[model samples]
Target: MTTSSNSPPLTPWGAAIITGVLLFLGYVGFDQFYLEWIFLLPLLWAIRDVRPRRAFLLGWVAGIVGHGGGFYWIIQMFQQFAGAPLPVGIVGLVLLAAANGVVLAVWAWGVSLLTRGRERHLVWIAPVLWTAIEKVWPEVFPNYLGASQYKVPHLTQIADFTGVLGVSFLVVYINATLYRILACRFEGKGVPWRAAAALGVTLVLVVAYGEFRIREVDGKVAAAQHLTVGLVQTNRGAADLHLSAGAIQQEHRDMSKALLAAKKADLVVWPEGVLSLGLPSREGTIPTWALGDLKVPLLFGACLQLNEEGETRFYNSALLADASGKILGTYDKTVLVPFGEYIPFGDVFPVLYAWSPYSSKFFSGKSVEPLKLGPHLLSVSICYEDIFPTHIRKLMRGGSEGRTPAVMFNLTNDSWYGNSTEPMEHLALASFRSIENRRSLVRVTNTGISAFVDPAGRITSRTGVWTREVLVDRVPLLEGTTVYGAFGDWIGWLCAVISLGAITLVTVSNRRDLTGKQNAL
Candidate 1:
């Protein structure tokens, strides 16, 4: 009896873990794209008619297992690059997993509260709840649920206006509809036409939007000005910094020279921090022409340190140079990485600052600045800055002090993730930024998946992973900004507002019912 009492809860634990596996198969991974449409069914079934607390626990398990599985590469990133101890890296991953699991736990709690001891019509409210949580999620390191369907062009078309939140809502709404229909059937009740109708209407609208948007884009692309842009993938990683920068610079020069000799490009872009070692001054007697003197201009990322007033300042900078090797202009990187670039809350906790790989703090650029390159000006984003949609739009806006660019350039180095799904995931999320602004995006990565993405979020030219290559493709420069650019993330805000308003109404209704019943008794 004493031994049995000391034993752990195997049955419940097993159920939770199993639910997580189901979620993973249904989400995204290794040719499981078709399974996404029905992924939530099993998780919903397991927690069906369960106590609110139990449901929340199950949801947390499923969330952690599924989401963590998608981003498991994070552990390798922490251990290998961030210099975290193996045990510490695992702990950090577990903590991240727990944080993600909490999002689903809260979602499950809402569902259980709404359906407990009452008709489950409120199950359809899952869309509202999901969109609300995702809207406020920090963009510093964003991972979207909708990114799972990135390969499906028709589904991603609506992202221009609704952003990724619209896609996430559609996914959850479908799950809710399926669960409700099945539950009603199991209970020997008539079919819920209202829930089915809502689901059908939502699908129809989404499909219709895709068709309309694609038609408009096709017409514009047919008659647009096509400019040849050269993208060089250095086949390098951040770890390569341990080696001398001369060899790395030589590789870039050789690649660019070969591509230029083969087909002359109007503009050439290199990956983030590709020229970190240092380039000699253009005015110096022995000036370095890394890419050789070409007809086309060059743009590349580097770290620039200079004195401002009495102090020294450091910047993650992108420099644009003319064909004659004259420095045109420089765009400083804004939206610096939290712990990676600078230690967060380091002033209060000095130990955290001491733990960083670098001693100097990188100063964030205050405004968006576009670089002039012959016929077109290019809006520049460095490293992880493109991940934030809001920040990207500000760069496109050309505010009062800035000029709008004909094209957008994301100089990134996703090589940090090694050979992982993160590179592809980042690519998918970056696509939306192009559609939202209705401008062509030139994404040049150090390793692979370097491509020319059109205004429609379609990849016209892309290179494979872990390869050394250069992609020279004709990309159309789109005119006029998208509605999403003018007014950003309105749909996300609206959905959040609707969810809060509905919750308030439900709480008031429940209280009124309780009061009436008490008086009658």
Candidate 2:
């Protein structure tokens, strides 16, 4: 009789462990196809029997599996492409997976603390806290959650103002609602049928609103002015191009001819460092002969030297020029890629800089501001900067002080990843930004996925990867900002504050109940 009683108590615990493992595996499987929605259901299942410590542990496991599966290609890049040994490459992959896992662990712990013992009500705390953590943790892993939501155009419209955190908030809320229903059932109580119904209604309302917004934008695009853009995709490997100065110039000339054919184009874009040499200053590294032949407002990626005080600083920069080849403006990439551009804490640990062949001290741009191009105000994002939704939001807000920009320009070199799903993933992210900001996005990538995306996140036209080709497309110059653009990350911040407050209140209440029971004893 005692053994039977003990077995009944252990049943839920065993079920919980099995459920968590299944959920982790589910997340990994879904990530293979980049179908993020599948993991949401399993995540809800795992959180149903949420003990604080168990929640944290389970979340960490899910995160490791999910990220390790999705970004396993990083291992291939390190070992095969970058030529790191097998063991070192594996260790690098593990470290990146662990770092990503930490974010989910923190999120799970926060949710557990907020919802502890209150397995009764449909607590709205988890979603808000999860969104808050998703927004802030990007300071560490800048290219994670928001970038993953690129394929969901209907949901990504919220990113213009709130950035990707807004989409994350909705996704988490839906999962939380699902968890609430399961928890109610587990406790052998009548299903909190009202809460479940409310959640369903809320989702419908949000989707309807998004559909309406998309329709409205579609109608406006038909009447809007269109700009012809020339995008250049140079299929050159970074390592192989370091051969000769003359060979590099010939490559740039060939790539430029592809763009020059699109004479009707208002803007011409080149991928990052298409010109292997640095930009010409007043002192002039590029001769007067090279400057005279340029046509159209050419935006090309190159390295540039900035003289500040007595120091000469080198920057990964985008140069803007007119038809006559006169330089107009230059935007340096502010958010530098760690290890790729410059080593982190290289001054303290110089040995770490020896890991990569690139410069150990590449400089970062000071501002996230937009550049002025003819009648249009343009926001220029270099390479991976397009993946960070918040940084893009700040750039848009800064540019739209009086009027919003006609379009957003992204200059990138995805050649490092070669012909892989990484480029497709990168394109998906750029498309989300286009829908979010209600602005046309023109992405010029080296070695493929060069395309134009409308404000509705539609890929109007694109070129093949690893192909040396020019893509010319007309994109609508959209007006009107999104709700997410206007508010910034206030929604995420509010959720975090409320979740923390709720946790504090619950902790206090639990302590009081414990005191009362002790006194009674």
Candidate 3:
């Protein structure tokens, strides 16, 4: 059971499988969710008294199972949209899961050191390290464990100040504390009062803060001037594989027109990549569409191809068109989705990807700018770009004119995910941005879950999956910056620093102890 053992107890395969399955059940990943506190208990138990390498392998297996299970929706997406073979899509899913497992392997080794040896006192550092690891998790596949708790509003409001890292830390802290208590019990220790008491107080403050935040945001939202925005979900996505670009554009235009029959909206939004033809969309031009007959400004996604220095570059752009059919501004998505948009390291290692999808690259946007929508300015995120908190903060910070947007819009096309759980999961992760910035957020998707989220991170209006509907609602736009809105990624950075300090402390202590033991001998 010594921490310096080169070989220790081997973890059974059953333990790893159980740990991963439990972790998967705790994710927004599934149709039903289980208690997150119990998710990591098995892994901690499996790794106890085991060598660091064995612990790492166990954790890696758990991660592979959990990640692959939670993100299985990706397989359906690839087959539906990318025209990928069933076997190829499955392989893609496994590859992604294995890639993410590396992070868990390191975490497993760190946890072994933290929960064992003379440095076991650093077990309390678990939450900090967990948050830092989440921040390190691939931005392309953003399924942070904290997102699963979005349904629990009381625990979610803490995201306002610390961003999602705070909620993630809290959840991980509970898991760590519970694991510690169980480990101590096995060792004949009654209880870890110091760590337990600290965790108890932290939970108390988290709940208390959530209540105060809810009350404060309610008052501000009630008194604030509301903007009426219409979200159009045309139910036209790449999944169908039959709808031509022109047909998709027509469906969106028809839906928007039908929605106007109810009441005029200040601004109308479309899902990303909905605009194909019937408008001057391709060839880097915005021609007049049937939407020109309407008296409201339109914001929608388009595929823009332009020639730069005799070289052609394509972009996934969200363009604004006035009622007069004049082009206003186009916000090209700066943060593109990996694999889905472009392959990572495709330029450096060309031979790595012979896949056709990886061959085409969409040029990244240099800047993120807010588009004008009637009297209020709107910050837009195309596709998966909305999930990045750092990028959303830049919008709140405003452009060179310092003209901050009162509303934020996320244009996404999730139909490729099919009837899977991703639409809701994606929505949950994006909701944190609303609270972080204290701005009204709207998601206009190609298929379903089109919603309007208030500054409190509450979903005021939402549509069912695969529904073709237009959501017309009043969005409460709160002014002024929030604590997290002003300080971007500070919490994640702080957790990273804490993790490094913990590692150093444990490593140095272990080294000194070995030296002292040798001298005594």
Model 2: lDDT equals 0.67
Question: What tens digits encode model 3's per-residue C-alpha lDDT throughout 19-97?
Answer: 7887777787563444676677777677766677877888899889988888898898768655578998999889888
Residues 296-395 of candidate 1 have per-residue lDDT tens digits of 7888887766565566677788888877767887888888776666677776887987786643367887757677776677789987677688889898
How many residue pairs clash in model 1? 0
How far off is model 3, as Cα RMSD?
3.3
Per-model CA lDDT versus the true structure? 0.74, 0.67, 0.77
Between which residue pairs do clashes occur in model 3?
A: 280-287
- Least well predicted 10-residue stretch by lDDT in candidate 1: 277-286
List ranges where model 3 is wrong by over 4 Å.
1-12, 31-34, 118-123, 137-139, 239-242, 277-287, 290-292, 345-360, 515-521
- Evaluation by TM-score, superior candidate among 2 and 3: 3
Candidate 3 has an lDDT of: 0.77
TM-score of each: 0.90, 0.86, 0.91
| Better candidate number, 1 or 3, judged by lDDT | 3
Compared with the true structure, what per-residue lDDT tens digits does model 2 show for residues 109-216? 766666555644434766677776766665433443545555556666666656666766766666667666765676577678887888778768767767887888
**Deviation from truth (RMSD, Å), model 2:** 4.2
